[model samples]
Target: MNSDIRQLEPKQLWNKFADLNAVPRPSKKEERVIAFMKDFGESLNLETMVDEVGNVIIKKPATPGMEDRKTVVMQSHLDMVHQKNADTDFDFDTQGIEMYVDGDWVKAKGTTLGADNGLGVATIMAILESNDIEHPAIEALFTIDEETGMTGAQGLKGGLLEGEILLNLDTEEDDEIGVGCAGGIDVTATRTYNEEDATEIKIGYTIAVKGLQGGHSGMQIHEGLGNANKIMNRLLFDGFENFGLRISEIDGGSLRNAIPRESFATIAVDAVHKEAFELEIKLLADSIKKEYKTMEPDMEVIVTSVDAPAKVMDLGVQEGLTRAIYAACNGVYRMSADIPDLVETSNNIARVIVKDGNIKIGCLTRSSVESSKMDLANMLRATFELTGCEVEFSGSYPGWTPNMDSAILKVMRALYVDLNNEEPHVAACHAGLECGILGTNYPEMDMISFGPNIKGAHSPDERAQISSAQKYWKFVLEILKQIPTK
Candidate 1:
């Protein structure tokens, strides 16, 4: 909170970030942060509007020399992904993200750094307050609940902004300018399995798989990181098949976009075979650890005693569900053959739960090509249906088709070349962006996304590079200065 700390460039942005950190702005709970931004805009005497869905738009006048330049929307999401290390005692709804300077990067104590769009929000605030920079008319567009889903951007009504161009500040890399992105949908499959009371099958123990480094399903899917849910399911399903164990309850994964980090299962086994089952689970864990040594060295599987009577799943239902789930699609399904560095199709086995006489599993499928996305979703849905489970699907959003000859991209490319010695990487992304939705709202507008270097987004290791803040600021200014007046 010191003024001197607030004066450093990225630290200045970090100061605003600190303000954000102090508030409880997790997805669907950003009223406090929205109010703060509204107050900040009012204090600056800038025109501000808070839309029906908590989207905020703060307008600032163009600088002296560029008063006639086209209006531009500097966009970012207001909410942050609430993730924490398994051992961290902090509550995301109350405590501030305890950030620290790690070399040139800024990271949280044991949780997500919220730099995905926090950096975007801070940079916009800094640009608004800078008295030395010259630029075009600006509309700071902050949307809510981007982490949970695209609800905020999807909820944005038409005719909310006067901007002719939109600049999305949510990309991760420092050198890449993302012009297009994949569209995705959340698919859930539920199987209602009857659980009957059974005689006290000698109580064994529950197995828990945790401490895995889960990351953004879209951004880090290609990294071959271990998914705790998948691994736990494999261990349980295979172990049960071989050890004759029965499951009492099974649950795994969290956010639809995050690769699951922790999973737990309570099983009922014959008391005599308990020792052998525990050893088998341990051996399975060791085998997987050795298999994915470079990717998931910190993986752990532990079995602990639970005091409970046997209420295991019916044999038929358990076998059907296990087979359906294990056979379900997960991780990166295909890498882009044409784009060299792009993930063309992918899916995340996002969430699984067993409760209230039913079992539900959710998977998110994404692709730059619409057909491929639907194909994968259908494949998974058919697999579930084949096993007698009910399936539900959501209407998918359209992908942003990349235009190599796009006018805004040309302007941005030229600006980057002018500011930096090298040209920016112009390409598409595997993750979703607001451009596809915004384009539908403003058919005449030109849009592109770029951002400072951010790493480990949607995970506890998330961080933003301190040095890239200045470079981002400089490039944004250059782009604004070069935009021709209508």
Candidate 2:
């Protein structure tokens, strides 16, 4: 139970995490969490204010003898990516996350653990509400909508902060210090298709692709894990090519940042081809399962018979749509030549929906290079446009350029070495972070990111390492004390 979660060592941190999880704070719908943070700052009698974009800022004076240190902006996002299992009955907008302790990790019941940025937020909150911890003049920045569009970071006006340095406590790996991150853009394709009447000779069937381990699109895109949308499209493409399958509706994936884990579709086929359709689909399912048996051992492709739909998509449009999806890029597009083993450009076919006479496909394309990013985006656009989709690009953001010569980077590297007796891996990650956007407004603030171990982010399997949190807490305290003097 969360009661046990609040009792975790360093009660200051876990207790705050428990408090924050009690409020529903889905991305783009952060009113309650924003208010909760505002009330929290006010309760402590700190200087609190809400920005025009719904970000909450709380300022706390320095501790005794620490007034000479440069001010620090401790930052984390307020909203979380809301994802749940297909069988988990939960409402992200109305209910708090149901959390529990499992060995050395805390997780939610068949839902996302929200540890991506929630842990960072809780860390800042703990320090803000504490009187015993030593620190410089603290500015706690809680930005909203970070999981979706990062509008809070983008809309933040300049000259609002007095901090000379920034500590972004949002990175996942404990053994790495983040110096840069990839930028991203949202690509959406939509078009209307003519509906054809389902003849009496047609029979209906449902196809479901589930049990895949979906994760963060940018961070885990290179893992070769199963993508439900791609997998579902493969089956549909094959079924139509062989047995003349007609799709009535297709629904796959949830958010553009998360790899698709589950997809379901309603399709129709001629009565004469029913047996062939089932046999071919199941055979292909077995083959596909064998292909991913190592990475996705629990992957299942379920087929069931149902009542035929009243209408189905035109054959020409269906053919084009399926082919375009099959041809589009879904995983790591390019690996960096400068950074070994790092994905430089990638795309996530995050969402696919087909209903009535409308079809929409959503993708999130990310890259460290602006030219490479647009190159892949245009490639996807041309592919979809050939199939008659009107594509629009939005939410474009720049990547954080690496600064190995940074003053804070030097301090944190030395600090990590002293604490763990080992050098931390200093590298740029593929995930999207708000630091790059915030830097545009505060150009001189030296930024760095580090955090505890979080695995399977942007998925239901998300969990935080307990021992790593304790180690990070120790590191946070030392970093605060070592903040460079003015």
Candidate 3:
């Protein structure tokens, strides 16, 4: 953590944020961070409890004369998406995040800043530790494993929280209040293939697609950015048909929630067609560069000569894999009928790998409507099944339906207008939020999500605006003061 961050406005919040940066809190590996939260809550003398699923909840009594106000549940995830640059030497499971101030933003060096939910958690910490701030009874909920899966939210039991109103501090834009979010599911397909001995008459080469500006699969899916896996598949399909290319290995993207930035494959080419293959690859690279010149200016494709492999995948399997990837859904499929510019359905062709005598593909699909989500899932199932691959879905979660008559929405909107003299934008997000899953457990809770301006979440370029953090803190304090009496 940088010393300058400690000097930022709203000293309490910034101080807690700086402390959070000193702990490693990647998804599904949040033992240390959870322990930190437990200690912090105990030190403050608050009523704290850890649920069976590892969710930390701290109850703070209302200030004197404000005991009649409704209990407010402030929620944020404890874990963060761990993404680092290909060249960075860092271990998210053991090393703390290195944070610094850049111009008007706070960012981590060559890694995700964890501002998506860390800032939210810090804000809750500041509220819990403050002695001068007046507010209603508060229940601060810090969930775990939100980035990879909503495990904490899914396992939380009803009656665990006594709050009637919930404020989810996980939205990205400072000026927008998120009332609803899309649901999502993971789809995986696999197929087995026989390996054959590489013939002596063939030469080996490694083809790679890299330098794409990959980002959050759901939030940045409509940006028109290139998918490295899709691009490599196109190149391989052409080579298989034109140059009799036989593939021995395939690997790409790591996470299912992030758009693929790079992909690599090793292939064998007939000695007689090696020269033609090289020329064809150069032409293809030039054409692709032109296609994504604006959206992915750094996109690159390279083919390098390598020693021949001992074994290669069957010719039929190679062709089938390429064809299946080419046909899979990879982007926004529909727009919301009620909300203009909102994405209603989308799919991310997240990952691909060939190992253990099988080729596996991973995908993530999201939609605000359940029917539309199932529709897209069936479409992807049909495409992969046609290629003789088995398809399965997992980790499915529901969407939060927007309530036009929400009490918190009415309170926050009026509060924003009074504070800034301008109406704040109230909208639904295309990305997944834990609110949807939590809503199922606490059906009567009135919920809304809002946070300081954060950009490039789930990617190495993630950052948060410093000024927005201070302003958000002030806004939250004011909302607490204005909560209605029960």
Candidate 4:
């Protein structure tokens, strides 16, 4: 299947993408990919260097007649979000993505397709290795761990590159040219609780929430897609209220940047009310399914008898935990008052874990405005703190401020109109891009972002549009040919 992808139109781009996806490159653990990129750069005999934080840079001198143009920084992150279905057996750390062509898209088997930034990385790779494509002097900046953190971009120092213009290939919509993006922070709530011995009269059942179309938390937050952690919390909350249900263990979600797709819990309820509990819960599950039928057609909530655990969570903490999760905001908190249809702020209840004597809830909050970002972060902090959890905010990065007057923006806008007789959607997005962090040091650089059409990013349903990739590749070549003169 990967070979098929390499054979697609614009073979150079798709082939590089296939090569990149073959490497196991999870966020915060990119040692293998780093070395792979280093070898690639060295093979071309270009001026290559790795930054202190492991960002890979490969410099390519401009071809004939383009040397006088401003040096362009072609940037994309090397890391990808790692997520899989509960039933999938593949190991992300050891196994390369198994991808296939489905109709007009390229999809992975029960895991993330890595198209979010992988396609971007591959685009840079193709351009760097090209012998005939005319372009200005190029500095290929492959930052690491953009998914887990922007540490790679944050650690990048000033004056490392001579480029005056930066082209970020990390946007999702092919018709949209991203001029700005939201910043994000990791808001986590953690605490420990006492574990009580399971009562003799309690009977155990497994509560599983599965089959939700999980996606990139930031990009898809406005789509009203279901979050598995939130759904599990809803069931547990109702169960406790009606049947004295207690939790023995819960492990839900995978990453902070990807919306949770499935959750499984071990719970016990009083045997005396077991019949009523099952009946009522089934009714509730039906309601949940009906509510999400349009958005989550395959969503399922199942309950089945299971061997009981020796211990369960303390009742007091369980109550507070469920309440806090229910009250905490998840989804579009506010839309940009200025940008039409642009999500200004949002949150995803990305992860939740409860077992033995501990509980942890992880969330990713994003906003284009810094004050609003912290406002929502503080709101979550207060909600969790009231329930006896210690809340902390970490990995905070600033948003990219849009420059409608950018020189490259003018050129790209005109190019789009000329090529397709249609104007591109030039706007900002809710998803975090490395442009803002990179701009922190390279404050004077002109930056713009555009990419191929990718759907269901950060989840197993993630796929890249085959036709859109062909369109995007042509656009990339045109943009390179039209680089502004120095």
Residue 163 alpha-carbon offset, candidate 4, angstroms:
0.6
RMSD to the hidden true structure, all candidates: 1.9, 0.7, 1.3, 0.8
Best by lDDT: 2
CA lDDT, every model vs. true structure:
0.83, 0.95, 0.91, 0.94
- With a 3 Å backbone cut-off (N, CA, C), the pairs that clash in candidate 2 are none
**lDDT of model 2, residue 468:** 93
Worst 10 residues of 1 by lDDT: 1-10
Ranking by lDDT: 2, 4, 3, 1
Please list the residue runs of candidate 2 whose C-alpha ends up more than 4 Å from where it truly belongs after superposition.
none
lDDT of 4 by residue, 391-416 (tens): 99999999999999999999999999
lDDT of 2 by residue, 137-196 (tens): 999999999989999999999988999999999999999999999999999999999999
Give the lDDT of residue 247 in candidate 4. Answer: 94
| Candidate 1 residue-wise lDDT, 291-312, digit = tens | 8889888888888888754577
Across 1-486, the per-residue lDDT of candidate 3 in tens digits comes to 578888888889888988998899988889999999999999999999999999999999999989999999999999988888888999998888888889889999998888979999999999999999999999999999988878999999999899999999999999999999999999899989999999999999999898887888887888998898999998998999899888899898878898888899998998999889999999998999899999899988989999988789987887888898999989999999999889999999989998557989999999999999999999999999988899999999999999979999999999999888999999999889999999998999999999999988888889999888877888999999999899
Choose 1 or 2, whichever is better by lDDT.
Answer: 2
Better of 1 and 4 by lDDT: 4
Off by over 4 Å in 3: none
- What RMSD value applies to candidate 4? 0.8
